[model samples]
Target: MTTAQAKTFITLFLAMLLTSCMVADSTPDNQWRIVDEGAYAADVSADAQLSVVSGINNGIHVWRFGEAQPLFQWSHQSEGGDQSNNLVANVHISADSLFAVTADREAFAIWSLTSGEPIGFWRIDESSIRDVAVSDNGRGVLVGRSNGKVMFFEPESGRRIEFLGHQERINSVDITPNGRYALTGGNDYVAYLWNTDSGQVIHTFTHPSRVTLVALDDEGRYAFTADSQQKSQIWNVQTGEPISQLQYIARQKIFTDAVFSKDGKYLLTGAPSRRLYLWEVATGKQVGEWKVAPRENMSPPSAVVYGVGFIDDKHVLSVSSSGLAELWSMP
Candidate 1:
């Protein structure tokens, strides 16, 4: 082939293989791009402004979309005294990227995303916290616990609201952008949504087995739930009616985390199967699947992913039990 023709053909192939938006039954494996490391992330989340990761490093870290390094990090470990090695279980960054909240084994804390300074901290009970969610403006924080209680903390006025969220330990939780509605999933075979102000259960969505994760779209109009039996369902928040039920392309897998895209067009799922799956929220159709490359020297067959989220419509972040944290984007 002519030199110019060869160059043109190579460029087209590279574009097709490198971008995350490649429309296929499965996204291109060549799209893999390891953007960050060092922390074994337990949960990863983002909004338009910032991306956050948390895990066994006993802290949460934040970064802008294209930056190679995190702007700041917060740790649960003591600086000097007892050297308590605490693990951060979950974290969420608000949509505005103004603040972030985290849940450790014993306490929940909020931090200023711009300054990297903590805004507030609270201790609810002896049981470790399981998950946390923050509002877009950073004033409201929802902290879920292993004891089945959901604690709402208002950092500005120092107010707290406690709700009996579930009969079993809470596993996942999320809040709407306006901070008016929140969703929780627990060891119980159910998911619950509550009016944050009145502290009342507005809807109860039951499953065949324990609910492992729950999430809401940016507008708070749609909710997603994944249960232990490998079923994932989407519902209309306003009506509490079933919208779409997503089935795994393969055998049943234990879902660890799930989230909707910023615009609510797509859904993401993480499982111990070492695979990440994306679906169309409107049709419940599988659009993409990316498996974490097997770790070096590890004999296990799967990567055991614990968390998955969209940094935006074009990028994806993942955290695994094997200490793998990475980012992939549409080239």
Candidate 2:
């Protein structure tokens, strides 16, 4: 990276670290801000400039950092829009807020946020698109297929780089903040890290159960992996060594999402238990746990924290399976 780029990253890194030290809510109800609700999926950009919200019947929405209403929305119009509920899928927005990608069971399309029109529209594989992520560079797109193959795309070059490793459906794929590496986990019980540019396998971590989610820290130095069972481990990205087995009092066997703090000092894991667990990266010890539910209403309230990302070191943004979005204060 150039000096400017390095400095920029360093500045952002420090900002995240400082945020982790924030003196905010000691409890969920006291210190959290609910940003959205009634959405199936949502993701915040790396820079937190925009948020992508997916709905069962309303299609997709892109909103600015502080806006309550979306700047744009898109939906399907076939079969009286009934299947639109099932058609709603994952959404990814570039850190620079220049492009957005929305994926459903059938196809995933690229849209120019500035132009408010699609730039690329195509299917990834014979099966559904399980997960999608945009490289930090905002130009490369990484997609995991339900068939277990991962594809890398460049909008300008129209280059599709494919990597084959897993045997079952890929559950999640995450790009390092520097955009140098891609980490993936699948139902095949394996997690693989790929060189984003070359589409080459860098490291493969095998688990005892089906791999459900994988995440990389901002600098790509560490990767987190979780399986369908209550198993989670941290790996050294550079050496492919298992750093430690993350031990926690997890009520659910299936973990849905995981993310590392920007400083790489802490890790967060979420599951169907309607809670997020924070672990100390150095010791692999559970340091904190927070329930994800917004209130005490227990009418089928065991919602999973399906999508999670660090908005800053001190705050986190998460989307529950029931479609509620909240900006939560970190401990």
Candidate 3:
């Protein structure tokens, strides 16, 4: 072959090899089991024993792993006098207690999962709460509101502890295991760490773009945040030092939600484009990617995955904007 032809052939071969690698890296080794469909929002508990999903006619449905149906259902609004509710934004479960925030800027309510009765409800500021995080011990709860505020509440005492920080809508909030510090991320492209007891801002980290999500590791030593710019960062919680940054393929828009595995060895991130990525915490390497196909029976994809959480190191729960929830086993 001519030298010029040989060079062209070599280039084509390399291009094909790179394409194959990308495909292989994105394929999932395990299958996704759909637990629920048509859910607007969903959350899995820290123990991974329960999942709460809300959307449309479904209100809030609580399910335990391996169960065929929901253990309990709660609605905010009544339909046909049958007690139907709508517009649930978030749900959280701790032990036998369940907490939910509705779409309307009204109140946050708590319920007893065992008895299926309302335990109590607290009126939050008339701003829509977008996300919430509960302390590992379930003593403290942090609510992120649309009005750029983080409200700390002690669920057991029904007392509001603090209202502080953020100049724009808070997208996510995370509390450390010991309940000493809380982290808030907002549309202002900043993430702030605050002292839970004193309600004081300890340090603020700026991102290149809007902050979409924030999470703290099990040991509370590392803080992770991601933005719409497809960049994920890790910071040393104690010194407020940047540890590492990972970039993903950019999309038109990405709802970046991240979680640290139970072992704190892996970080999982979900994007808008039906792709989920797992990263190694120590080496900052991409370990796996799961590709979810768009629902062939529907007009669009199953739904843009809103959040991802590790059930253990081997299993994960992914919730979509359309309210479809799934559990995947990681290899």
Each candidate's TM vs. the true structure? 0.80, 0.78, 0.80
How many residue pairs clash in all the candidates, one count each?
Answer: 2, 4, 3
Ranking by lDDT: 1, 2, 3
The digit string of per-residue lDDT tens for model 3 on 6-69 reads 9999999989877854543233334333333455666666555666767555467777765677
The total of clashing pairs for model 3 equals 3
**Candidate 2 TM-score, true structure as reference:** 0.78
Per-residue lDDT over 19-137 for candidate 2, one digit per residue giving the tens place of the 0 to 100 score:
86443322443222223345566666655556677764466777665555667876533334345334656777665567777777776777777867777666544777888877544
Candidate 3 displacement at residue 200 in angstroms: 1.0
Ranking by TM-score: 3, 1, 2
Candidate 1 residue lDDT tens string, 1-331: 9999999999998797666444232233222222233334455545533556664434566655456566887675433523353566566778666878776677767788778887766666657788888988897898888888888878888788888868989888888877888899899888999988988999999998888888888767689988877678999999999888896544455777777786778888877767788888888888777776554466754466666767666878776655555565633
Candidate 2 — what's its lDDT?
Answer: 0.71
Candidate with best lDDT: 1
